[model samples]
Target: MSDTLTIALAQINPVVGDVAGNIRLIRDARARAAAAGADLVVFGELCVCGYPPEDLVLKGAFLESCEAAVHDLAEETAEGPAMLVGAPWRVAGKLHNAALLLDHGRVAATRLKHNLPNYGVFDEARVFVAGPAPGPVAFRGIRLGVMVCEDMWYPDVAETLGESGAEILVVLNGSPFEMDKPNLRLEHARARIAETGLPLVYVNQVGGQDELVFDGSSFVLDGQGRPAAGVAPWTDAVEITRWSREPDGWCCEGALAAPVSRLENVYRALVTGLRDYVVKNGFPGVVLGLSGGIDSALCAAIAVDALGPDKVWCVMMPSPYTSADSLEDAALVAGMLGTRLDTISIEPAMAVFGSMLAPVFAGREADITEENLQSRARGLTLMGISNKFGPMVLSTGNKSEMSCGYATLYGDMCGGYAVLKDVYKTTVFALSSWRNHTRPPGCLGPGGAVMPERVIAKPPSAELKPNQTDQDSLPPYDVLDAILDCLIEGEMSVPETCAHGFDEDMVRRVWRMLDRAEYKRRQAPPGVKVSSRAFGRERRYPITNAFTRLI
Candidate 1:
């Protein structure tokens, strides 16, 4: 029997449906692990075809490709350290999220995922059937309990594995990032360790997948529920851990990363999400309307941080309502970021639109329609630039503006991706201020301030009209964000929300606006999801509902 073992946790980013590319990633990680003298290398869940492949796993061809890739990878184990990787495996004509153990150049054993998550950005139940409770997989004279992502959440699987004589519990995860998710993951892992009385190893994938951003905060916990080792969050890493068979149980020793602040995590999530979306989808770069407003300024900074200044193209599409302070702020932001900024006057287009629509409306007063025209004109200018160039337009509206319908549809909302779609206005201000003082690790932007101090301190405005500010239409951001958190994330009713020391009428008003803006959000571009209750797949509300009225 082996007295000691070395295991390498592979925290990698894989693109969904890219089987061959994923194989290369696995091979690369295995090679690094072999160099580190590891006995076995473990990767995250569904690393063969990427996690949450959604409906891509349903296709017979895709499953066959994944299986072929797994077998091919299994052959590589003939000469190097064995590998434990996750893939979509089909057994007895039923598909399962399986973890395959590759040893001696062949597929040695497979453990299917017992618990399929069906809530909150996860819908595995609809794709694959859950497998029976899994036992330990024997490797190098030791029994290792292997669990898929959701399997570790509950106790039944860990209990079964422990009772079946598993020595170490290993979990393969594709858990996405939320502000509170890291703590929750550690809590669950510690709980499992407490129940099984066995050391645990967690390996999670890092990268952006659609609206989801997986923070690879992979970690290890000893039998006593103490942290033995950890991989840093928001980046790919291959960490090797040494495990020894102690008298009581197995103990692990490795490096532990420092804790990341909540604001840093949120900012990193945005940067990772934007970087992956643009790179994976084959966009050359990003172009955003750099208004003097906080939302747009923050978006510009995030874009530069994600794709360097050379890749980010900013345009100042000024209109008659644009103020001198706004013009100066936009120019200063662009200069500090070292990005290419161009000024395009939308006045000509607005005048042309007004002349074109004058015959249809002879005596109609200039209301929001005219204001919307300015936004549309700006949107058109940006889109035209995108079409001529290969850069994608980035929408800069935050969750608060989107929730209250304070944003114009297809105007400022026109973009292939929204960087701040899930972020609140208060969070936006906080992130901008934080970025000015500190630059998170792995960021491509400069270490100094990304924008002028006045940009953050100034009042946020769309500048659609003279002396216009965001508060002209919406409540104070602090109040609005708190009420939004209660209604959306907390799922509290009007009475419950108002009980949080808010006016009942204002709470009801906010509810109505949130409900009414569903269609707009539905049409909005996908952005990073840092909150527990993001707008897209996580939180879905009916466009034509009377729930708000009844409330």
Candidate 2:
């Protein structure tokens, strides 16, 4: 076996369903690797049609398009180095998540994924059939084993490949971020290397698609399960590593850099997710409703930082109940950020709706139905602007409102993307404070106090009715977010949430609302998921369930 082989991994972003565009990306990346004198280039999982094509894979024409794109990619390999790229291949009338080995202007071999993850945000079992035995392909005078995304999660894939005369293992991944998931990936990879006694390279996709964000923390581990080379998170890079075969198998010879902070990594993931959602979808810019509330304020900061002031338009839709402080605070914050600000009073539309629904009210006492109408009217005005202009409307509701049915269905929830839908209310406040103290890398605003002090200090409210606060219907946000953390993220039973010094009644109340709100969450726009158990795709609850939490 030869000792000196150079491998290149291209951690690049690919938009879903953009076959021609993705092929161009692959061609460009492979050209760069060939220019650097590398033997072969590897890309992340599902590079042809992009990661988690979701239901797009179900379409026969789309899969055919992906296949056509892969063939075009295989021909390009003749001009450069061999390419190990991930895509979908149908064999025996079943679709498999596969990686193709391209050399000498053709596909030399295909490696299919074995483990299909069905938990959390993954539903691979529903889409792809599990692969069979592992095999090694001869590329550049070396036998290399290729494993797709979830295949790397299991030890059997690496062990079988290593035992079958494979010299190196390369795994392509479209793994989504979930808090400390990168650390978990490293730990799992080390264990697999220790068991297989083979050097391994892991490459992952970067950027946000819908509710999922892929953190590109691609790294190489030596035969002894030691770190070799790595690329940073939430950014695109092409990393080339030189390896040598030893008595023990293969080892890496290079100086490894320090790892970035967890805070920094997560913050970058949010930014990347935001940037991709806006750019890839072909929106001219983004428009957000700027309530002085923490959720809207945080989303405005993220939008301005992601797309800059010229692209972000902030509107203050004040109602009769709108506080002078909230209106002033919102305008003040928008001024600091330098984004285009517009105020559209909803009172006129409110009168129209009020008059229209007067017969139905029938002299009854006004309730939350009237309050929700106010929210829905505001939503319609924003949509009207979005229809006339090309800017995408960005909704500001957080995970807490999304989880407990606190948000109106077509009201505050209407938008192209829910910027903070995956972020908890508590986290919204924390990130807001963090942004005020120290801005992120590309924040487009004044130095001090992007959000007003009064905004953060005041008690939260919908302000639909006179003197109505959020606590009237729910607990304190501090208490409410914590209980939700336990119930939703922690997956705690009703009793388990109460164990955390919470009142049992409050815990039960939060849990009940969370259970009943499943339908609303299903209809929400995609948001950047920052936690393990964001309300959509991950934690599923039946909308029709009748079980009640006992007090």
Candidate 3:
């Protein structure tokens, strides 16, 4: 009998629905762990078909492919260490989120996930059928209990495992990032360990799959409810941790690096998410218009940092009303970042479009409509370049503009991805300053002055019309972002927002704009989500609603 076990946590990035590729990853990870003398190697949830396969699980062919992949993985374990991996299993006409125990080139045992999370970016109920609470599976000599993603969020799952004579509990997960979520996971694991008195190992996937960024801070919690070992966020690493059975319980011998700061972690998540999306989706590079405003500058910086200077292209689509300072600062940023810079003056395109639409707008006084034309012309030019070349167009609009419908639809909103869609305007400024001063971990771009000083200090504007600024239409970004956090993220009622030192009228106005902008947001492209309440799946607001207050 063994009194100690060394387990490997495979913090890997899986491409969605790539069964063959995913199986290869699992095999490679198991081999690495075996070479390190680990007893078993565990991977994130849904390793076979990838996480949140969405509706792809409904297809019979896909399930068959998943089964075939599992068989291949089982076969690959012939020479390596044991494997505990997650996959979708269909039994008796019901689908289950299952964790399989593979040993000696065969399917040793199977455990089904009990919890099916259906809320907030998760639609497990639509794809998966929950299984009864699984008992412990004996691997080698140790009994291990397995839980899928949502199972760790609760206490009973771990307690049931502890009661069933399980020595270690391993959780496979694909949890996404949303501002301090790693800390929340740590707290939850601590609570679970306190309840069960069992060592817990959590392995999570890392990468961006359609607006969701999973920060792979896979960790192990000892019986004392403290973190024993882990990997960093926004990275892929395989770590083998040794745990010994002591008089008290399983004790960890060594842990990994310290946890990253919230800011740094979130920033890495955004960069990782964007980089993976652009590369994995087969885009050669990215192109975006730089307005010298914080949003565009920050997006450009993130693009360059994500994909190197070779992969990022910056175009200055200056219009008639574009300020000299804006033009100079935009050029400065492009030059500093070493991006392939080009100037596509939208004046010519704007004139052509204006003439084409002149008969239609014959009598209507030139309002925001004409200004939006210029924005759309710029959008078309960027898109044309994206089509002529192969780079995906990255939208530079932030959450604040998206929230208040301040962005022109089919104008600045045209893009394959929006990097700053989840970030607030105030936060955009903060990130810009942060990027200018500090280089992100693993960032390939140059460290200093990625964004120009003047770009960070300038007042935000669209430059669509003469003397037009964001403040002309909406509240100052600081005030507006606060109110939006209250209305959209905090879910505060207008009265509650007013209680927080905001004027009632202003609060009502901001709330009204947020309500009216649902249509625009619905049509907006998917972007990396860095906040708790992103406009996409996290918060669902009706496009047409008469009710104003939640109460």
Candidate 4:
């Protein structure tokens, strides 16, 4: 029987459906683990073909490729440390999310995921069938309880493994990042440790996958539910932990990363999501309209931080209603970030459109149609630059603007990706202030304030018309965000929302707006999913419906 063991937790970023690239990542991690003298290397769920492969796992050829890659990886384990990796496997004519143990140039054992998640950002039940409750896999004289991502969430699996004589619990996860998710993960892990009286190890994937961003806050918990070791969030890491069999149970020893602040984590999520989406999709750089407003300014800062200032191109498209303060702020922001700034006036386009449409409306007064034309002109200007320079246009609409349909359809919403799509306006102000005071690790932007303080302090405006503030069309951001949280995140009814000290009439109005804007949200670009109930796959609502009235 072995008295000592070394397990290397490999936190890696894998692209979905890229079998060869994923294999290379796995092999590189294995080589590093072997050099560190590890007995086993543990990787996240679906490391072979990436996590949440969506419907890609349904393809027979993709599954065959992943299976072949696993075999090839197993052959490499003959002379080095064994590996425990996750991949989709076809067993008995049914596909399962299986964790395979590779040793001695062969596949030793496999454990299928028992609980398939079907809520929030996950739909694993649609693609993978649930396996029977797993016991433990024997490795180097230690019976290790192996549970896939969702399996650790329930008690039945852990209890079964503990009763079956499992020594340690290892969980392979691809859990996406939401606010307060790290603490929630720890709570669940501690619960399992309490039930089993066995130490647990968690390994999670890190990277941007479509709207989802996986924060790899992998950690280890002792038998007494105390933190033994951990890796930081928002980055890929390979941490080696030492374990020795003590009299009571197995103990772990390693360094613990400092806890990250909520604001810092949210900012990092935005940067990481934007970086991977632009880089993984093979875009040279990003071009965004840098309005003087808080939303566009924050989007510019995030883009500059994600891709270096050199790769970020900012343009200021001023209209007749554009304030001089906005022009000055935009220029100062560009200078501070060291990004190229260009000026393009949309006055000519507005004039041309007005003249072209004069025949249809001989005596019609100016209204929202004219305001929308200004936004569309600016959108066209940005898209034209994008086409000429091969850069993706970034939209700068936040959740608050998107929620009440306060944004123009093709105007501000014209972008390949929306960096602040899921972020509320109030949170945008908070993040801007936080970034100014502190610069997080792995950022390419300047250390000091990226924008003038007045930018955040000023009232937000679209600048479509004169002396117009966001409040002219919508409620105050603080109130609007709170009401939105209740309706969207809490899924509270009108009366329930009003119970939170909100006026009944206002709550009903907000609810109506929220329901009416579903179609606009349907056409919006995908952004990072940081909230619990993001608007995409996580929260789906039918556009044409009478459910709102009934509620």
All models: lDDT?
0.93, 0.83, 0.86, 0.93
Q: What would the TM-scores of all predictions be?
A: 0.99, 0.94, 0.98, 0.99
Could you tell me which residue pairs clash in candidate 2? Answer: none
Our model 3 lands, by Cα RMSD against the true structure, at: 1.4
Q: How many clashing pairs does model 4 include?
A: 0
Misplaced by over 4 Å in model 4 are: none
lDDT digits (tens) for residues 98-145 of candidate 3:
999887898889888898998888888888888887788887777887
Q: What TM-score would you give candidate 1 relative to the actual structure?
A: 0.99
> In order, what is each prediction's RMSD in angstroms?
0.8, 2.2, 1.4, 0.8
Candidate 1 pairs with clashing backbones: none
How far residue 11's Cα lies from its native spot in candidate 3, in Å, is: 0.4
Better of 1 and 2 by lDDT: 1
Which residue pairs in candidate 3 collide? none
Candidate 2 residues 319-411, lDDT tens each?
Answer: 989999889888888887888889999999989988998998887998888899999988898898899998999998988888788999899
Which candidate do you rate higher for TM-score, 1 or 2? 1
Q: Model 3, 541: alpha-carbon shift in Å?
A: 1.9
Residue 495 lDDT in candidate 2: 82
